[model samples]
Target: MTVTHALEGDVLRRQDPELADLLLGERERQASTLQLIAAENFTSPAVLAALGSPLANKYAEGYPGARHHGGCEIADVAERLAVERAKALFGAEHANVQAHSGSSAVLAAYAALLRPGDTVLALGLPYGGHLTHGSPANFSGRWFDFVGYGVDAESGLIDHDQVRTLARTRRPKAIVCGSIAYPRHIDYAFFREVADEVGAYLIADAAHPIGLVAGGAAPSPVPYADVVCATTHKVLRGPRGGMILCGAELAERVDRAVFPFTQGGAQMHTIAAKAVAFGEAATEAFAVYTHQVVANARALAAALAAEGLVVTTGGTDTHLITADPAPLGVDGRTARGRLAAAGLVMDCCALPHADLRGLRLGTAAVTTQGMREAEMIRIAAFIGQALRDEASAPRVREQVRDLAGAFPP
Candidate 1:
C-alpha cells in the first residue's frame, strides 16, 4: 500500500480525526523539511505496506516453525523469508531478524557470547561509539566491565595503537568495533587480529555501515566479526529494526539469546518488511544508490569544510558526517536550533577530544529522496547562510522548503 492509502484512508479519519490530523501533520512535515538525521532513512512503499499488513496482528513468540503462538503458519513463512534473504544479502551463515532494535541485537550478542561481569573493550563515547558499545547508562556498561579506547586528538581518527594496547592489557572477553558519529571506514581485519591476539570474541556493531556493505560500497564485517549487529534502517532503507549475523555453529545460541533471554513475541509485520528491504538491497539499482550516498556525503562534507566547519576525519567515507560548527561563530547545539528554525533538521553529537558538541548529519534520507551531490552542495551553502546571518532565517527557510519540495520526499 502507498503512504496515501495508509494515512489518508477513511477508516482512521472517520474513527479519530485527531490522530489522523496528527499523522497528516507529520507527513506534511516530512515532505516539506529536509531530514538530515544520521540515523534516519526513507523506506520503500513496499516495505511500508508490509509493515501495515495483516501480519501485524499475529503474535509469534518463537522462531519460525517452533513458535509458541497458534495461527502463526504465515508468520513462519514471512520470518523464514526474512532470514534467508538476510543470509543471502550479507553472505552470512546464519541470520537472526527478531531483535527489536540495534541495541537489542547487541544485547543478544552479549547474551550469546559473554556472561555478566565479563570484561569488554570498545571505542569510547567521546569517539563516536554507540551506547550499546559501552555507555554507563546502558545495560552493557552496567553488566560488563567495559574498557574504552579513544581516537587521536589532532587527527580525529581511531587510535589503532591505543586499541591494541588496551586489548593486550585488559584482555577483555569481547572486543567491539563500530561507531555512530565516525565518518571513516573501520578496519575490521585489524580488530579481528586484536581479538585473536587477546583470545576474545569480536563483535562488530555495524549499525551504521551495514547498508553500504550490502551494496558493496563498503567492506563487509561478516567475514571477520564473530558476531555482527546492525539496524535495518539508516542507509539500509528498511523498516526500523535490528538483525544479527553469525556462523552456523552460533545460530542456535544467537536465536536463544534473542528470544528467550532478551525479548519475546516477535513482530512479524516488521520481519516481513525487512525481507522486502533485503530484496531491494540486492538489486543493482540499490548498489548505485549506495554509491551515490557516499558521493553525496563526500561532497557535502567538503562543502561544509569549505564553510569553515572542522570536518572530522577530513571527510566522510560513508553516508554519515560529523563536523564541529564552532568556526561558524556558534556551537553545535546553537547551530542545530538555528538550522531547525531555518528548516534544516539534524542532530548534535559529542566532538572527539572537545568539550563542546558537533553537528551530525547524513545523506541517506535525502539520497533516498533522489537528491544528488549538487543538492548536497546547495544544502551546505544553505546551512552556512542559516548560521552566518540570524536575520536571513526566513529566506533560508523558504529556500529549504523549495529544495525539499523539489526532492518531494
Candidate 2:
C-alpha cells in the first residue's frame, strides 16, 4: 500500500520538503504510466484524507465502547459507523474493521476458528493463492497443518471435484477459497457445500473481488462463507486496511482475535476511511466502476490473446487476467521488467504445473482513470510491441504517456 500522497500544497512542504517532493514524484510516476497490479488501486481523495487525519493520534486499545483505555468517544462512533457500513455493504451479520491488514484479518479468522495443530485446506500460493492462505513461510501454514488445492494443469481454473476429493481425504478443520490471481468467478455456494460435507469452516478471502461482490459483478461470499476476509484497498478502492465479516455466532471470537490475539490497538483513521469506502461502494456510481473494471479486464485478456499471448483461463470474469508471455518469446519475469520500463506496471505469478510464470494484469486502476475496452486493446498492443523486442519500448512508452494523460490518474 504505497501511498503517493497528493497532499494539498504547502502544508507538507513546510513540514518536510523532501517527503513532499518524493510524493509529487510518485504521483507523476503514476500519472505517466499504467498500473496493472492486480491487488492495487488508487483510492479516492477522501480516503487519502482519512489516512492522514488527526485520528492517527488515537490509541483506543479495544473495540468501540469496550475499550481498555478511555478518551474513545469519537473512536467508538467512527468504528461503529465502519462496522455498520461494512455489514450493510456486504449483507453480513457482523463486521470487524479492526484487523490491520488482509493478512491480519486472515490470521484473525484462523485464530477464531482453529487451534495450533488444526488442519486447513487452501489454494497454494505458487498457483495464485495468497501467503496467508497457507504458504509454508506464513503463520497459517507454520502453526496449522495446511493442505492445498490448485487450478487444473491444462485449464487454469479451480477444479471443485479435486477440491472435494482433497477435502474428504484431508478432513481439514477449515477449507479456504478465493484467490489473488484467479480470473474467474468463484462458486462460494459450492465451497460452502463442500465445507458442510467435511464439517469444515469456510473462510473466503475476498481481498481481490470485494468491490465486484459489492457491485453485483461477482458472487458475494457472505451468504455461504462462515467468515470473509478482505482488504479495504485493491479493487475495493479504499484505505490500506483489512476487515472480517461473519455471522453473529462468531463475532466475539473474531473481534477478540483481531484485537489482542493478532494485533493491538486499532487504526482508527484507516477504519474511518474504510467506512467512507464502504459507503462509496454502496453507491450506483461505484457499481458502474466495477462493471467497467470487469469489462476492461475481459477486453484486455482478449486483446492479449489476439496478440498470441497465452491468456490463462481463456479470459476473465473479473478485474484480473493472468497471461503467459512465452508466445511473445519472453519469460514472465523478463516481460514484466520490459513492460514496466515501457511504462506499464504489473507482476508475474507462477503457472500451475508449468515451468513458465504467468503475468497478472488488472483493470481496477485504469478503470478508475475512466479507461474502457478501447484503451485496454491499445495497452495490450503496447505490451505486445514491448515483449517482441525491448527496442520497441521507447515508442510504446510515449504512447502510454499520451494514453495515461488522456485519462489523468
Candidate 3:
C-alpha cells in the first residue's frame, strides 16, 4: 500500500476505537458545519501526516549543527527544509521554524529586540490587535511599556495619520501593524515610512493574512518590516505551529532568541508539516484557493448585511469579516450561540470604542473544504434565520447538514 493508504489503515486498526470514533465525528462536524472561525483552516492530508510522523519522538535542542543533543540528522533535515521553504515563500533573509505557536514567535521577536520596560506601540486589543501585541496580561504588555493606536470612528478603519502622530510622540522601540478583526488591507509601505520617520522598528503580525501573502493575494510585510511573525495553522493550512522571519542583520539574534531565550527544543514533526504546507502554498491552486477565500468572505458579508446586520468597515478585503448584530437585537455572544445551534461556527469579538456590536466570521475553513460563493450564501441565510428566530434552529441545522453533505471532508 502507498504511504497514504498505509497511514489510513493504521489509524483505523491501531488507534483507540473510541478516540477514532471521536475524530471521525469531529471531521464530520467540520465537513458539515458552516465554519466561520477567523483563525481556523483545514490542512492537507500530506501536511496532516507529516505532523503525526515519528519525528515527534526526536529532541533537537538547538539550531542545526549546534544542537546539544545527538542523532539530529533527520531533525536537521526537517528544520532545514522548513527554513528554506519559508525563506523561498516569503523572500526573507532568515527564517526560524522552531516556535511552537505564534505567541512563542512573538515572544522570541520581543525578547531578541527589546529590553524590559522599553516602550512599544501596537494597535489596541479592542480594535482587533492580538494579545501578544501588547495586552498587559501578555508578556509584551507586562514587560514592555505599551502605548496604543486605534481605528478611526468615522471610517471604522486604521488611521495612518494617527499612527504616525503616535509614533512621533511615543517614540516606541517597535511599532506593530496588524489585526485579527479589521477587514481591510494593511498599508505596510505606509507603516514602513512611519517607522523610519520615528526611528522605530516595524514588526508585523501577519498571523491572519500569511496565507494571502504566500498566495500573492495580499501585500507582504516580508519586504517592509524588520521582523514578521506568523502562525502556520490559520490561512497557511499547516500544523499548529509558528515561524519567525527576519532580514540578514537580525538573523543571529532571532535564532538565539528562538532557542535559549524562548523555546527549549524544536518540534520536528511540526517542522516537517510546515515544509509540506509551504510547498503546497507555492502552487497555483493555493493562489486560487486564497482568492476563493476572500470572495467567499465578501459574499457572506453581503448576505449578512442584507439581513440587517452591520459589517465592520462596510465589507472585508480578507478571509474574515466582523459584523454588528445590534440591528437584530442580539449581542455577539447571542448571535454566536444561535448560529452554533444552527450548525454555523463563528466567534464573538468586541470592537474598539464601540458597543458590543460585532461578530467575527471567516471563510478559510469552509473554503478549504471546497465551499464557494453558493455555499456562503446558504450559510449566511441560515445565520440570518437563526438570528431572526432562534426557534427555527433545527430546520436551519438540517440545511447546514445537507450543504455539508455536498462537500464531504
lDDT of each: 0.94, 0.91, 0.88
For TM-score, the strongest prediction is: 1
Candidate 3 residue runs with Cα over 4 Å from true position: 1-15
> Which of candidates 1 and 3 is the stronger one according to lDDT?
1
Residue-level lDDT tens digits of model 3 in 325-370: 8898889988889889999888999876876847998999888878
**Model 2 regions more than 4 Å off:** 1-8
The TM-score that candidate 3 achieves is 0.96
Model 1 lDDT per residue over 261-310, tens place: 99999999999999999999999999999999999999999999998898
TM-score of 2: 0.97
Clashing residue pairs for model 1: none
Residue 194 error, candidate 1, Å: 0.6
TM-scores, all models, native as reference: 0.99, 0.97, 0.96
Candidate 2 lDDT by residue in tens digits, 265-363 = 888999999999999999999999999999999999999999989988899999999999998889899999999999999999888778878798899
Model 2 Cα displacement at 167 (Å)? 1.1
Ten-residue segment with the worst summed lDDT in candidate 1?
Answer: 1-10
Candidate 1 displacement at residue 10 in angstroms = 0.9
Off by over 4 Å in 1: none
